[model samples]
Target: MASGASDCHFHGNAVATQATVSTCAAKYQKDLIASGKIAKSWAAVKEPASFEQIDGEKGKEWKVTFKDPAAADKSKESLYMFFTAQGNFIAANHTGK
Candidate 1:
């Protein structure tokens, strides 16, 4: 489980992989989750299915305007996902476990 300001990795469809998450950016990483690019969703068959909000234009779009470790920049390479909240996988993006 990745934490603030650090770096973490979340497996998504073939579109994204860090080879390790540390090198990734926070914005891109959260995008994967919020955009429903997770690996679990890639599978055609499964015991259960899941999805991400992507914060539709009608609703609220996810933003990273403010955060701890203030050092986190939106321009980072986030190509993975992490848990932004507990038990809530959709919004969760890679944080650096």
Candidate 2:
């Protein structure tokens, strides 16, 4: 997490605050770029296209989506990053599955 980034807090349970989740998503995106999983142009995107909480069979999860106009494939244009309720990264994919 970056300096002064919002801290994760608990509301009944250990759930990450939206700001904290957003920061996590951003860091994950940067990691993707560094690993050559995504275009370096992704670094230009300062914010996600959307952020939401998903309710699944296991439990709650956070999704941070970013749109990259420079992507070679339309299906790959949207990067979906998933994080646990506690702000721990789970996985990332273009399929959003």
TM-score attained by model 2: 0.81
Cα error of candidate 1 at position 82, Å: 17
lDDT of each: 0.31, 0.81
Question: 34-87, model 2: which lDDT tens digit per residue?
Answer: 999888888988899998999845799998899988787888888999887878
Error of 1 at 74 (Å): 29
Model 2 lDDT vs. the true structure?
0.81
> Which segments of model 2 are wrong by more than 4 Å?
1-12
TM-score of each: 0.17, 0.81
Determine the backbone clash count of candidate 1: 17
